[model samples]
Target: MILEFRTYRLKPGTSEDFLRVMAEDSVPLLEKAGLRVVDFGRSLVAEDGHEEAYLIRAFSSLEEHERQEREFYGSEAWLAGPREAIVSRIESYHTIAIETSEEAVEALGRR
Candidate 1:
């Protein structure tokens, strides 16, 4: 599987609003497009009080990931609804070919 990790640096005091919109709207929309949201998180200690949040999306392969992105941006949800609400200013960082050792995967499974 391949994972896409997105980190959001949110305007201070808007973490709750961001989380609510994500849970109520964004997640469902992505799921509909076949992208699984593996995890979501927020920073506890903000740099100079600016909030940060992260989202991890999982796909079976790179091709699947690309296909999902196309569908997501082309969908009604992207054009007219939930996606419009949750996003403020977004800065995207990219990572490729993450390697997880077997021991780490086993340890995570135990959790």
Candidate 2:
């Protein structure tokens, strides 16, 4: 499986609003494209007070991930959305899981 990691920095004092919008709107939109939000949260303390959030999406393969991105950008969710207002900066990473160590996978499952 492949994981898509997205790190975000929200505008000052907008962490709560950002999380709410992500939960109510952004997440659902991604779900429609077969991208699952395995994890997401904000940092309690960060340099410059810039909140950090991340999402882990599991993909069947690299090709599937690419297809999802294409569909996501072309969808209505991307064309018109409140996400533009909430996110200040975004960094994305695509990783391939060579081994789903039992302990690691189990730990994540518990959460």
Candidate 3:
């Protein structure tokens, strides 16, 4: 399996709003698109004086990840749905995917 870790640097004062939109709107869309949507929320600590958050998703392979992301991000459900609410809060973001054990992913999910 592959585990994707996404980190977001949110605009100042937008963490609460962003997290709400993500939980309410973003996560359902991701799950509907067949993505794992493991976990996501504002970071407990901040860096460089900006709000921070992270999201994790599990996929069977990198190819599945790419395809699913392309389809989901391009679909109207995302573009017309939470896209604005989700993207507008972010100052920047980055994503990294790594190969890992199912056991490791399960351990992460337990957190």
Candidate 4:
């Protein structure tokens, strides 16, 4: 299995706004595109003098993750939704794909 770990650094004073939009707008759109959003929350550990939020998504493969994300980004739903606003709040974003054991996957509630 593969996990797509995404971290976002928000602009100063924008963390709360970002999280609100993430839950109400982004997560639902991602789910509609078949992305299995496993978890998302503010980071307990600070980094780079920015407020950080992370999202973990389980996927069958990195290829699938890329395909789904590409489609999602191009969709009319995304264009019409909060994409622009959400991105404007982010100072930086990063993503990494990791291979994981079945046990680890299940432990992440990805069954």
Candidate 5:
């Protein structure tokens, strides 16, 4: 299994709106497109600057992750959905994907 962790540095004071869009729209949309959204929420403290948030997902493999994300991004469901609201609030973001055991993933979910 593989895990994809996305960390976002959002525009100041946008955490509430950003997380709302993510929970209410983005997560469901990605799941509909065959992605597993493990968890997502605002961080307790900003990592670098502004407001910080994160999204974690589980994928069968890196190739599957890449393909699914590509299709989801290109799909009209995304372009016409919460894409603007989700993207506009982000100042910057980074992703880290790595192979992991189910136990490891379960541990993350427990948090």
Candidate 6:
């Protein structure tokens, strides 16, 4: 399996709004396209005034991840949803992809 860790450095004071939109709009859309939405949270450690939003999603393989990404991004649903609102509030973003074993996934208490 592969896990993707995504971090969004939100514009100051936008964390709560971003998280609310993600919970209401973003996650359901991604899950509909077959990505496993593992977790979402705020970072405890942050810059003096900047807040970060963290997300974890998993896939069976890189190929699967690519396929789902294409589907999600290409969908009209995504275009019409909270994507614009989500992107506009972000100051920066970063992502890390890691290969892992099923055992490791289970160890994290995730399927």
- Best TM-score among the predictions, by candidate number: 3
Range of the 10 consecutive residues with the lowest summed lDDT in candidate 2? 91-100
lDDT of 3 by residue, 1-111 (tens): 999999999999999999999888899889888889888987888986789999999999999999999999999999999999999999999999999988888888833
Worst 10 residues of 1 by lDDT: 102-111
Clash pairs (backbone) in predicted model 5? none
Model 2 C-alpha lDDT versus the unseen true structure? 0.63
lDDT of each: 0.68, 0.63, 0.91, 0.86, 0.90, 0.86
* Superior candidate under TM-score, 2 versus 4: 4
Query: For each predicted model, how many residue pairs clash, with residues at least 3 apart or on different chains?
Result: 0, 0, 0, 0, 0, 0
lDDT tens digits, residue span 4-75, model 4 = 789998899999989999899988888888888888878897786779998888888878978888898999
Candidate 4 versus truth, CA RMSD in Å, comes to 2.0
Tens-place lDDT digits, model 6, residues 1-111 = 998899999999899999998888898888886778888878888976689988888889999989988988888888988789899999999999999987776666442
TM-score of each: 0.76, 0.72, 0.96, 0.90, 0.93, 0.90
Residues 3-23 of candidate 1 have per-residue lDDT tens digits of: 566778776567888888887
What does the lDDT read for residue 91 in candidate 5? 93
Worst 10 residues of 6 by lDDT: 102-111
Q: List all candidate RMSDs to the true structure.
A: 3.6, 3.6, 1.1, 2.0, 1.5, 1.8
Report the candidate with higher lDDT, 4 versus 5. 5
Scanning candidate 5 in windows of ten residues, the lowest lDDT window is 102-111
| Top model number, lDDT | 3
lDDT of 6: 0.86
**lDDT value, residue 82 of candidate 3:** 95
lDDT of 5: 0.90
lDDT string, candidate 2, 14-111, tens digits: 67777787778787777776775566677566657566665666666778778887888777776687557444434322344443444443355312
- For residue 31, give model 5's deviation from the true position in Å: 1.1
